[model samples]
Target: MAKWRGPRAALAVAAGAGVIAGLTLRTAEYPGMLPAGTPDPELGLGLRLVCAAAVLIAATLAYLTFARRQDEPLAMTCLPGLVVTGVVLRHLVVTLPGAARISPAARIVPGAGAWVLLGSGVVMTAAGLAAAFAVRKTA
Candidate 1:
């Protein structure tokens, strides 16, 4: 067994990031932060955190599997970057009041796509955190 110290650290960081991002996303809200009739965004922060963690875990597992095979370095780097970009975007959207001006649901209702974006951001943040931690541990 090729000691899983790297993966373990990655998982831990991913879990932490997920919790943080979920809470952040939930906080930057307007009336529950869901598209109405969407079950009040589930358990809000907790659910988002779990979703983020799962995404990170899945991506980390993929990296481990590919590294074992030794033929997907390109894919690994690109995938992680894409995930980071998404996370960053979500963070900006949530943190910036400017984004709120865009009317997430101008043609629909307020805070419509914001919920979806927040959810996606949660996933990406987890993946980015996992990759970042795994790489740091290895290096």
Candidate 2:
């Protein structure tokens, strides 16, 4: 068993998770958008973070997989990044436009898609947290 395999696998998984998270944001049901109809519900900070994380993770994984293990401390660093990214993503999703942005008459109710987003985000965050903790424990 090679030492690099662990980090390589983790990065690939994180990239896949990132892709799923980005897809969930695509569905309708804008939860916290001010004005209730923010044209593009798909554009959010969480999505950006996950997408960025995914790309960065994948790139890091690719480099690690091919470039040879340069350092002992670099394995699974993306998991911690995933943990932070997932938390930020969920946070942005839960409080999208912020309370002050919405008018008193406007009430945002989550649709089925919104529920899906929330649920997926929670699961993603939980998984990231668990992975991060596990990585720490092992180290």
Candidate closest to the true structure, highest TM-score = 2
Displacement of residue 51 (Cα, Å) in model 1 is 9.0
The window of 10 residues in a row where model 1 has the poorest summed lDDT is 69-78
Evaluate residue 43 in candidate 1 and report its C-alpha lDDT on the 0 to 100 scale: 30
Compute the lDDT for candidate 2.
0.46
* TM-score (C-alpha) between model 1 and the true structure: 0.31
On a 0 to 100 scale, what is the lDDT of residue 2 in model 2? 45
Instruction: List all candidate RMSDs to the true structure.
Output: 9.2, 6.2
Question: Taking the tens digit of each residue's C-alpha lDDT, what string does model 1 give over 73-133?
Answer: 2124334334444544544444334444444542222243345444444444444454555
Assess each prediction's global lDDT (C-alpha) against the native: 0.43, 0.46
Residue pairs in steric clash, candidate 1? none
Please give me the total number of clashing residue pairs in predicted model 1.
Answer: 0
